[model samples]
Target: MSIQLGSNQEPPKQERSAETRRQLLDAAADELLDGGFARFTTHGVARRAGISRGAQQHHFPHKHRLVTAAVHHLAERSLQQLEGITSDGSLNSTRRVLDALFEQYAGPLFAAMLDLSLAARADEQLRDAVQREEHTVNRMIDEWAHRRLTGCDDAPADFDELFAMAISTVRGVAVLRLLGHSQESVQRQWKYTRDQLLRLLVENRS
Candidate 1:
């Protein structure tokens, strides 16, 4: 019989721990996206992350914190992408940047946020947490929009209003996918809006 030494196993490396944390957050994001709060489960997330239940708990002692952290993780990643894209003074580049920003609203992070938002409508503590996270995200996006609008020649006096409207339209378009709208239909509307918005920006008009 071979005897295993109990003390021989090495503890997980710092890099490994961070990786596991990321995996758990990603799994939580997916869980929130797929079924919102109704289907969220600590065990389910742990399994999805390929980690043991204890391991998950060790990383996130509370489930709510984990969910919030998952949103934070996604926000951080989006900010990185936002920073990477250069703002060349061209209408096409502007469109690309806008598309990327809109993508963050349409992607898995947004789904997870929708889950949190719905839950927060009734839960006070959760609502507070979600609001704080949302405020952080909104602040970042606010700066991003302002940055994109800068250095463009002859921007309209109502440029702020126009930008707000455009953001709202893109966000609504994102929600349409959740309402079972076909991609073809969504794409059609999106393209029309894209073209018109591109022109407005390129022309620097309302």
Candidate 2:
């Protein structure tokens, strides 16, 4: 139940009882990645992580707790991966970030998560967490788009236009990829989409 923010030097440590909790989260992620949330079980996670069932309960106590925490952890990991991709200031850094994000869940894992997301509509808490994660990710993307678009004085007259276009373009690419499109096709279409969006953002820029 104890969490510490990162300090100036070393990484913050979790509470004494958090080791098992971390393991449960890791196991849940593997289960979700392999079989989606429908197949996720506390017992299965415990076995996968090499801990007792009671130990898993001692950490999660309920399935919902584990579900929410695992989703949050995945979202954070995705963000960190993006941060790494964007670390370099190369011309294709943004494209690299987008590609990296898509690469992680390129196959059945993405499909499973999307199915689980649809199924979670009946669960208000789970739905809210998913919405919040999506909001955070989209907000970051929007901010990056704004910065890139606003680099020059003669860029788009309205920031909202650029943000909306960026959001719509990415959403379209994701939907296409999830609907059984090949990765090669996704990459081709994504390149076109990215180029068009960048053109809109920097079209009139000095």
Candidate 3:
């Protein structure tokens, strides 16, 4: 008599492989966040992932490949989360949009990206890999913003420049948080920057 597999049955090999890869990517991001790029290692990631070193190497043989892949993986995950948060129609106003963007920039994903970017400055191969990953993520973000932002359809002539400035300002605040700044100070600075950007947007709309 043949037995039927229940919902609790183990996943297929392919599904398990994908799950392992996902875990490795998550662990890789955590390693970068906890130890930074300078101390990141494949063995460390494997251990953090609770997988064998050979398994980790099977997916990513080089450190640069692993970290770059992790960066892209985390970015994709973060964007999906952002979509869920913003799709509820609660982000109706420009201020709410700015708040969401700032929260995302200050999150662990951006923190990991910043660490990789700084390390890339001295490593040519890693720099190339990081640049490629960053370009892909930036394109994804641009598409997301176009679809979700409120004023894009009637944006100013220099909309891209203004948007770039907004992103830069948020990133600067995020870096300050990473450097152990006080919460009150960070929030104050972010409020000032947010107000300035809102004023610019309003002025441009006129």
| Top candidate by TM-score | 3
TM-score of each: 0.76, 0.73, 0.81
The residue-by-residue lDDT of candidate 3 on 1-206, one tens digit each, is 99998899998899999999999999998898788888999999999999999999999999999999988888888788767544322224666767777777777877778788888898899999998998888677656754555434556677668777777777788678877789899999999988887776544565
Please list all clashing residue pairs in model 1, or write none if there are none.
none
lDDT of 2 by residue, 124-173 (tens): 87787766755654566555544543444454467567657666667668
Weakest ten-residue segment in model 1 by summed lDDT: 197-206
Clashes of 1: 0
Candidate 1 wrongly placed segments (more than 4 Å): 1-16, 81-84, 151-161
Model 2 misplaced regions, further than 4 Å: 1-14, 87-91, 98-112, 123-125, 132-157
Give the distance in Å from residue 5's predicted Cα in candidate 1 to where it truly belongs.
Answer: 19
Count of steric clashes across candidates, in order: 0, 0, 0
- Stretches of candidate 3 off by over 4 Å are 1-10, 87-92, 151-161, 202-206
lDDT tens per residue, model 1, 72-134: 877877788787775644787778877886677777777778778988898888898898998
lDDT of 1 at 77: 75
